[model samples]
Target: MEEIKLNEVEPYVWEINKEGDMLVPGRVYGDKDIIQHLLDDVKQGKEWNALKQIKNVACLPGIQKASLAMSDVHPGYGFCIGGVGAFDVNEGVISVAGVGFDVNCGVRTMSTPFTKDEILKVQEQLADSLYNTVPAGVGSTGDIRLDKDEIDEVLLRGAKFSMERGYGTKGDLDFIEENGFISGADPEAVSDVAKRRQFKQIGTLGAGNHYLEVQYVDKVYDEAAAKAYGLSEGQVLVSIHCGSRALGHQIGTDYLKTLEAASKKYNIPIRERELVCAPFSSEEGQKYFSAVNAGINCAFANRQAIAHLARKAFTSVLGGSGDDIKTFYEIGHNNAKLEKHDVNGELKKLIVHRKGSTRAFGPGRDEVPEQYRAVGQPVLVGGTMGTHSFILHGTEKGMRDTFGSAIHGAGRAMSRKGALSCCRGNDVLRELRDKGILVRGHSIKGIAEEAPKAYKPVEEVVDVMHNTGIAKKVVSVLPLISIKG
Candidate 1:
């Protein structure tokens, strides 16, 4: 890999001038230290050298303005993780690698009236109850089995299906992106294999970096925004990190092969084979879009069911009534969406691919929930198991600058294998316990790979987002008890 010179555009922005087949400049948001660390990773060749990937992403057809990378940028399959690129709908192409296999893989946060002291008292019992109630580990399944008709409902109604089944209330939908459902999802576009896999996994939390954590608001940066989010210092909350599960993975794998073959048929030239894509108006593109929408719906439902299970654990441990806890916000990352944006001077519809990036729609955006319209959409940034998480609100500057996108999380500093080699799972659990965080998981090795040291400092990432005016910090949270898949 060649070292590209990065010019400092501002205190929080860096740019790489266009070169080779690159159609636009590459922009990254981060501090000097984070930039240097990413540069070192390129030198070591242990992970995706993100800088080159960012440049490669610029080569995609019909990309508008620039190929933007967030502070958490890391090398992914084709587009770098944390990459945000928008392309003209009429002229652009949709690539499977850009959207990722885990479509709508995201985080959801719920705040409760309980206090930190109240939670710590029953932390161990709550963790064990959650671990038992929520099916996890590789290829985990749950009690809820959906038939063909029911599967179609899940793909269309998302969290609404769970609400109708008495898992959640109507008000909960108001806080989720797209009311926890993506319209225009055609279940017929989903293959039988994908449907079969999702049949029994609706309420389960699958393995590998997915978790349900019991956290407390440690500090408030913006008091008004924190209060609007129903959070106060020492207040207990639950954060669920999950994705579309097997259904989404199957769709990506199945369609990418088709798209690759179609790319050859269409005679589209590309530097990388993983960047397989079809024109937006093509039949293949429409089919993949439908499958992607279905996957997004699956993720929304997955998080809702997991939240229901978490509520059960809370009620079992705290003896809470139905109205004691409520969902604060549910948002997704790692997906693509059709959005309207100004290109040069004309407002045009574009397909925005946010891989490992979160949509940070600014104030007045119609897509934002009415309750949060004044404050902007809430952006949940989860850290590693034993570190601080942050709540941020989208800013108008983000809309004007980066297609209304922001960093998703503290990007991985090392691969899971590398992190596990450096830290033992038992030691990590002990350390977390020492810090007053009760931890429970099915596998000890899972804990080792997700150790706090394995990821970049979330504080730094939030700082960059704040400094860059993409998102502003609302509050900071710390875990009291956590359950890992």
Candidate 2:
């Protein structure tokens, strides 16, 4: 590992000046405390070497502007989690590592007409019901087992596949990012092995940081924005957080070898083999992109199925037909999308790769649903278990500064192994129960690994985004019931 140094560029902005084959500067966003933590990690010779990873991303081909890290950034495969980078579509490259193994892994919030009081009274039963209805953990299979042809349809149609099957409403599509169906998803691009791995895993919440929680809006920061998002203080909401399951992992595994070979063929210099990629216009790049896009749809459909199951669970526990649970919005944090953005005051097509980062398109953009166009895109920020999550909206400052992006979560402060060493799963469960929060999990090991102390304080991360004007906070949600895989 190489030593990386940072210089304060501005408030909440730190820069790693271009050096040693770097194509652009690397920038990270965070308050003094968070920034110091990153520096401290580097000093301690820790593996979450975010600064070095950021510098590595800056060295990639055709990278535009800079390699950007959001407030929640922590080192990941190639680009750090919360990493953001865009490149010229014709000249740039696409890496499966950039989009991450869990493609389109994201968060979706569904607000209900019920209040906190209504939910807490049955929190125990609700937790059990959710756990029973939704499949979770490693190798957990869901009720909806798709055949080969139906799986192909799911790969092509995404949430619409579930919607037509009576899983969700047609109106729910508009509230999802890319209308819950990203285009250019070709089933043929995905390998049969990847397809086989995905056959029985449609709605499962595969383990390691994936979960579904029931929460309530405990604080309203921006009244107008909260109103626009159909949120109010004391309102109950359920957040589904998972992704493409085995489908994405298999796609990444299958393409990494191809990209590594393509990198050599294209004569693209590699500072880190983890960042393997080919020119976006190259055949290898197009194939992987199409395959990854299909994986994104698979994730959308997976979440849709989970959402349907959640509705059923809520109906069984709380009374109403689940119609009262309204989709606030669904957005992916891991993805690469082709879009047109202003470059040097001129519109240019670019492929924006955001790994562990959420798209935060601002007001007036057609990408934002018409109902929310005035406020901007809703950004869902999930917190650690027993912590408070947040609802934020996009801002123009974020669009100009970070290609319309924001951090996805309170990034890991400790690895799962490290967390397990210090925390006991049974103890964590007891503590959360003491805090008036109910939790259910497949195993104690899973619970210990996701201990609340294993993450940076989410409030601090959310504050940095809010203060920096990347995303404006609307409300804070306190967990009542948590179901982890």
Candidate 3:
């Protein structure tokens, strides 16, 4: 690998201008140092480069404007992590690789009345309680088991389905993105294999970068936004970060095979084998879209159920009904949405794919919940177990430039295998304990794979989004306890 040349098109915007095989230009949002670090990876001969993935996405059919990479960009299958691409609804293609295996893998943060001191005092007990309550790791199953009819209902109704089982409140839906459900989800489109995988997997925090964390609002950068979001200094927050579990993986796998053949039948050329897709209007594409919508709903329901478990764990440990533990916001990263966006001075319908990216709708967007419409959509950027996470508000600039999107997490700086080789799980656990962060995981290997050093500096990643006016920082949350899978 050599230096991958990029033109600094503007402040905080780097571009790999359109060339051979690219239908659109590739753009990445980050500062000089962040951009340079990405370029240096080429110099170091890193096999995977985010910029290359962005360029590959640009080569896909019907890509509109540009292939965009958010501030927390990192290489992943097909599209880079933190990649955002909007395709023309009529002409563009829908690809499974655009939405990773873990469809709608996302995060939700809730505020608690308890202060940091209060949670810290019983952190160990709370950790044990949460670990015992929430099922985790690969093949982890939970108490919530559903019949075929019930599973279909969960696929269609999302969090509301879980709430019907006495897991959450109707009020919680108000704070969830898309009101905790996406319309047009078709259970029939979801394969029988996928449904079988999900029957007993609901409410489980399946592994690799998935966890339920207890954090405290350590800092507030925007007083007004923080207040509107119900945050205060030293306030404890619970963040449930997981997804549709094995169900999403099975759905992605099932669809990939269908789309692979559909791509050929539809005469869509493939640049990368992983980028198999069908035109949006095609029958295969419509079915995949509907199935993916169901997968997204499954994730919403999954998180809703897990939130209920966390609340119960809190109630048992702290001795209260725990109404004060209210939902801050729920948003997904791995998804593709059909939306109407202003493109080239005309509002056109598009399917925007955000793989490891978040929707950051700005102030006044009707899609934003009424309570926060005056501010903007809340974006949750999760950090590694040993780092600080952040809350940010969407910006008008993001809507104007990147189709209202921002990065979703601290992008991995190293592979899990690399982290495991260098960091011992017991040593990592000890380090977190020394810092007063209690952690419980199914295995020491899981802890080692998620060691903090596996990711980039979280502040630097968030700074690019904040500085570039994509998402404005509201507050920072530091982990006090983490229950991992």
Candidate 4:
């Protein structure tokens, strides 16, 4: 790989000039140390060569202005993890690779009336209860079984289906992106195999990087924003991170094969087979998009069901009504959406694919929930197992600069293999316990794979976002107990 010329645009922003078929420049947001680390990764031939992925993304059809890579940028299927690219709807194509297999795999956080003092008393019991009530582990099935008709309703209604069935409150929907449901989902576009896979897994937390964490507010940065989010020091919070599970993986696998065979029919040149795509307006493309929307809804429903189970666990331990636990916000990082953006002084609707990136729409954007319209969309950034997570609000600068997108997580510094080589699962668990954190997992190997040393320091990543004006910090949280599936 040729040396990537990184121009320091600001304290936290770097730019790579357009080259080798790239239609626009590639931009990255990170501090000097991160940039150097990225360079080292490139030198070592790890696929996180974000510079190349950014350029590859710029070369995609109808990409406007620039291809933006967040500080968390790492190797992914087509786009890098933490990659953000927007293409003109009338002129662009949609690639299944841009949206990974876990369509709408995202995170949601909830605030609880309980405090650290109260939670500590039953921490172990809470962890055990949650693990039992919420189905987890590889290929785990739950009690919520859905037939074909019910599955269609779930795809159409998303979290609303669960809420109506007494899973959660209407307030939860108001705080979710698109009210937890993206319209235009066509269940008919979903394959029978995918449907069957989702039948028994509607409420389960699938394995691999998926988890449910019980945390407490560790610090407050922006007092006003923290107050608006109903967060205060020592307050308890629950975060659920998972995705569409088998249904989504099957959808991506099924459609990618179709797109691969049909790419020749559309005369779309293949720069990378993994980047296979179809014209946005084409029949195959539309069908795939519809199915992807259904997958997104599936995730919303999945999380809602998990939230219901989580509430039950909390009540069993805390002895209170479920009202004590209320949703803060839910956001999706995987998948693409049809959005209107200003491109070269002209506003055009486009299909924006944000893989491992969160939508950080600034204040006044209609998409922001009504209660939070003044403060901008909330951005949830999860750290490593024993690190600090942050709540950030979108900034006006972010909206003008990067199509209202921001970093999603700490991003892996080392692969799972590297992490396992460094430490054993039992040792990692003991260390976490020593640090005052309780952990429960379906497998010990899973715990070892996500060791804190495997990820970049989330604090540094958040600082880059703050310095770059992409998103401003609201508060910081530390984990008290975490459950991994």
Query: Which candidate leads the pack in TM-score?
Result: 2
**What are the TM-scores, per candidate, against the unseen true structure?**
0.97, 0.98, 0.97, 0.97
Model 3 per-residue lDDT tens digits across residues 8-95 = 8888899998988889999998878778878887778877778878888998889999999998888788788889989998899888
Model 3 compared with the native: what TM-score?
0.97
User: Poorest 10 consecutive residues of model 4 by lDDT?
Assistant: 44-53
Residue-pair clashes, model 1? 0
**TM-score of candidate 1 to 2 decimals:** 0.97
Residue-wise C-alpha lDDT for candidate 2, range 1-485, written one tens digit per residue: 55778888877888899998789999999988888888888889886577878988898898888999999998888788899989898999998778988999999789888888988888888999999999999878998888888888988888888888788854778889988998999899999999999889998988989999999999999999988877899999999999999989988888988999999999986766678899999999999989988999999999998999999999999887888787889999999999778877988888999999999999989999999999999999999889999989999998888899998999988889999999999999999999999999998999999999999999998998998899999999999999999
Off by over 4 Å in 4: 45-48
User: What are the clashing pairs of model 1?
Assistant: none
lDDT on C-alpha atoms for all candidate structures? 0.87, 0.90, 0.90, 0.87
Candidate 2 vs candidate 4: the lDDT winner is 2
How far off is residue 241 in model 3, in Å? 0.7
RMSD of 4: 1.4
| Ten residues in sequence with the least summed lDDT for candidate 2 | 1-10
Q: Cα miss at 326, model 3 (Å)?
A: 0.9
